[model samples]
Target: MRNIYFVRHSIQDLSVQDDASAPLTKAGNVLAKELTRLFINKSITAIYSSPYARAFQTVLPTAEKLDLIIDTHADLRERQAIWRLDWQEHLANLWQDFELKADGEESFADVERRIVPAFQQIYDDTEGDIIITGHGTALSVLFHHLTHGQFTFSDWQNMNMPDVYIGHFSDENVLVGLEKIAR
Candidate 1:
C-alpha cells in the first residue's frame, strides 16, 4: 500500500487581496505549528508544495522538522481564473458558474490534468509516505480525482483548514482507501 497525504494549506490572510502572494495569517501560523508537531512523528519521505506563499508556508514547518527542502511545483498552485471578477462576486457564483472559468486562472479540468501527473510521479518514485500541501479548491478537486469521483462538495465543506486526507493505492494504481485524517 502506498500512502499519500493531501493537506490543505492553513488559513490565508484574505485581507491581502492579491491572488498569488497571500501569506498565512496568525491563526494559520498557529495551525502550521500544530501540524508540524503532528508530522514530526510520522515518516514523511517526500514533501511537495504549491508555488504560492501560503501553501509553502503551511509546509515549511514540517519541512524544517524533517530537514527536507520542499519541492515546489507550479502545477500545484491554486486554481487560476480565466476571467477577472470581484472576489466577493466570484464567491457568490462559485459552484453555480460551471462555464465561468477565470481569465488568469486555471479551470478545474486544468488543475486535474496537472495534479494527476504530479501524484503519479510521486507514486512511481516513492515507496513510503508522501505529503502534499496545496490550496482548498484545488485539493478538493484532487480528492475527487483520487477517490475516483466519490468525494463531493459536501465532503469538501466538511474539511477544515490544514485538513489531511489519506489515500491508499494498490499496486495496480487503483485507490484502495480514501479517508480524512482526524488530526
Candidate 2:
C-alpha cells in the first residue's frame, strides 16, 4: 500500500493584494510547526507544494525538519482568477457551474486537466509515503478525480485550512481509502 498526504495550506494573511503572494499568518506559522510535528514520524519520502507563497510557507517547516526539498507544481495552485476582482462572486459562480471561467481564470475542468496529471505522475513516480501541500479547490478536484467523482462540492466546502487528506492506493493504482483530518 502507498499513501499520499495532501495538506491544504494553513491560514493566510488576507490583507495582501496578490493572493499568490499572500504569506501565512502568525497562527498559520504555528500551525505549520504543528504540521511538522504531525508528519515527523510518518516517514514521508518526498514533499511537494503549490507555488503560492502560503502553501510554500505551510510546507517549509516540515521540509526543513525532514531535510527534504519541497518541489512545487503550478497546477497545485487554487482555482486561478477567483482571487481577482469580485472574487467572492467568482467563487460562487465556480460552484454554481464548474465550467464557468472569467478572463484569465480557470474552469474546474481546466484545473482538473492540469492538476490530475501532475498528481498521477507523482503517484506513479514516487515511492513510499509522500506529502503534497496544496490549495482547497485544486486538492478537491484531485480527490474527485481519484475517487471517480465520488467526492463533491460539499466535501470541498467542508475542507479546513491545513486539513490533512490521506489517500491510500493499491499497487494497481486503485484508491483503497481516503481520509480527511482537520487540524
Candidate 3:
C-alpha cells in the first residue's frame, strides 16, 4: 500500500496586486510552519507543488525542513481558465460553462488530464509516502477522481489551508481509502 497526502496551499492574500503571484501571507506562513512540525516524524518521500507562487510558498517550509526540493507540475496548478477572469465572473462560470470559453487557460477537464497523469507517475516512482501541494478546486477534482467521483467540493472544503488528506492506493493504483486530516 502507498500513502498519498494531498495538501491544500496555505492562505493567499488576494489583496495583493497579482493574484497568481500572491505568495503566502503572514498567516499562511505561520500555518505552514506549524504544518511542517507534523511531518517531522513522517518520511515524506517527495514534495510536489503547483507552479503558482502561493502553492509553492505553502510547501516551502516543509521542504526546507526535510532538505528536499519541491517538484513543480503544471497539472497541479489551479483551474487556469477561471483564474484569468474576475473572481466573481470566474466563480459564476465555474459551476456552468467552464469548457465553453475559447481561451488558452485550462478547464476542470484539462486539470484532470494533467493531474491524473502526474498522480500516476508519482505513484509509480515512489513506494512510501508522497506529498502534493495544490489549489483547492484542482485538488477537489483530483480527490473526486481518486474516490471514484464520490467526494465533492463541499466535502473537501472542510479542509483548511495546509490540511492533509491521507489516501491509500492499492497495487492496481486504485485509491482505497481517503481519510481527511482534522486540524
Candidate 4:
C-alpha cells in the first residue's frame, strides 16, 4: 500500500516569537533524534518538510538516516497570520470557521489553497512511503481533507508535539486506512 506519514513537529520553543524561526526545545531535540525509528525498514522514497526551522529540525534525523534530502515547501509552513495571544481560543474559532479572520489574518481556506496543491504535487511525484514533516495546524488541515472530515480540531488538539499518522492510499488517491503512530 502507498503510505504517507504526516508528521507534526515536536515541541517548539514557545519563547521564540516568529513561528518560522523557532527551533526545537531541548526535549524536542531529543524526541526528534528518535524520529528515524518510525521509518525503519519502510521504503521512504522522499522526505518533505516545511522550511520552518522547527519543522526542518524535527525531520533532519530521519532524512539523514534514510540518506534523503529534505524538500522544503513554503506552502507547508504554518498559517502565517496575526492571531490573538490566546491561541487556543483563536484556533478553536478557526476550526469552527475556516474562513473566519480579521485584518491581516490568513484564513484556513487560504492555507488550503496552497497546501492541497502542494500535497498533490508531492503525492504525484513520489512513490513508496512518503514523509511530510510540518506544523500542527498545517498537517491537521491536510489530514482532515484526506480523511474526509474524520481528522478534526479535536484530533489536532490532542496531537503530540511529535505526532505521526500513517494513511494508506489507493492508486486512485482514496484513503483506505488511517492510524496514528504512537510510540
Candidate 5:
C-alpha cells in the first residue's frame, strides 16, 4: 500500500510580510520536531515540500532523521494572497466560487490548476510512503480534490498548524482510505 502524508506547515512568523521568506515560529519549530514521532516506522521514502521557508522548515526534522533531501516544488506553495489571522470569511468567500479571483489574488481555480498536476506528477512517479509539506489553503485545496469534494472549507478552517493527513492508495489512481493524523 502507498501512503501519502500531507503535512501542513506549523505556525509561521506573520511579522514577515513575505510569505516565501517567512519562517516558522520558535514554538512551531518545537512542534515541527514533534512531527517526527508520527512518521517513525512508517517507511517514508521521500520528502517533498513547498519551496516556501515555513513549509520547508516544517518537514526538516523528518528529512534529517531519514537522511533524505527535501524536494521543493513551487506549485506546493500557498494560495497567492495576503491572508490575515481574521480572514476566515475571506477564505469562505473564495471557496464559494472556485473561479473568483480577488484583487491581487489567484482564484481557487488557478491554484488548483498548478497544484493538482504537480501532485499528480508526484503521485505517479513516487514510490513508497511520501511526505508532502505545504500550506493550509493549498493542501486543503488538494485534499478537497482528492476526496471528491468531501473535504470542505469547514474542514480547512478547523485544520491545525502542523497538521498531518494520511491517504492510502490501495490501487493505482485511486485513494482507498483517508484520515487526519490526530495527536
Candidate 6:
C-alpha cells in the first residue's frame, strides 16, 4: 500500500488581499509548526504544494524539517470562485452537480479534470509517503474523487484550516482507506 497525505493550508492573513500571494497569519505560523509534528517518523518522500503562499507556507515547516524539496502545481490551487454572489452556495451546488459553473468560476468537473491527474501523477511517480499542501475546495474535490464519493459536502464544510487527510492506495490506484489526521 502507498500513503499520501493532503494538508490544507493554515489560516490566511486576509489583510494581504492577494489570493495567490497572501501569506499565513501569525497563528497560522504556529499551526505550521504543529503541522511538522505529524510527519515525525513517516519518512515522507516528497512535499508538493499549491503555488499560493499560504499553502506553501503551511507545509514549509515539514519540508524544512525533513530536508525535502517542495514542488508546486498550478492545478492544486483553490477552486476559482470569482462569481459575484453567494459563492459558498454556488460551490455547494457545483459540487452536487459537477457541471455547474459561474461565468468566471472553475466548475467541479473542470477542477477534477485538472487536479485528479496531477494527484495521480504525483502518487505514481513517487515512492513512500507523500505530503501535499493544497486549498480547501480543491482538496475537497480531489478527496471526493480519491475516495470515490465516500466523503461529502458536509465533510468539506467541516474541514478545518490546516487539516490533514491521509489516504492508503493500492498498486492500481484504488483507495483502500482514508483517514483524517486530527490537527
Write down the worst ten-residue block by lDDT for model 5. Answer: 82-91
lDDT of 2 by residue, 97-156 (tens): 778897887898888899988888877778999999999988988888888878877888
lDDT of each: 0.80, 0.87, 0.79, 0.88, 0.90, 0.90
TM-score, candidate 3, is 0.85
lDDT of 6 by residue, 3-27 (tens): 9998999999999868999999999
- What TM-score would every model get versus the actual structure? 0.86, 0.91, 0.85, 0.95, 0.96, 0.96
The candidate scoring highest on lDDT is 5
Which ranking of candidates, highest lDDT first?
5, 6, 4, 2, 1, 3
* lDDT-superior candidate, 3 or 5: 5
Could you give the C-alpha RMSD of every candidate to the true structure, in order shown? 2.8, 1.9, 2.7, 1.2, 1.4, 1.2
User: In model 4, which regions exceed 4 Å deviation?
Assistant: none
Candidate 1 vs candidate 3, lDDT winner? 1
Tell me which residue pairs clash in candidate 3.
none
The segments of candidate 5 whose C-alpha lies over 4 angstroms from its true place after superposition are 83-86
Could you give me the TM-score of model 2 versus the true structure? Answer: 0.91
Work out candidate 5's RMSD over C-alphas.
Answer: 1.4
Give the Å shift of residue 53 in candidate 1. 0.7
- Model 3: runs farther than 4 Å from truth? 83-105
- Ten contiguous residues minimizing lDDT sum, candidate 6: 83-92
Candidates 1 and 2, the one with greater TM-score = 2
Instruction: Please identify which of the two predictions, 4 or 5, would achieve the higher lDDT against the true structure.
Output: 5
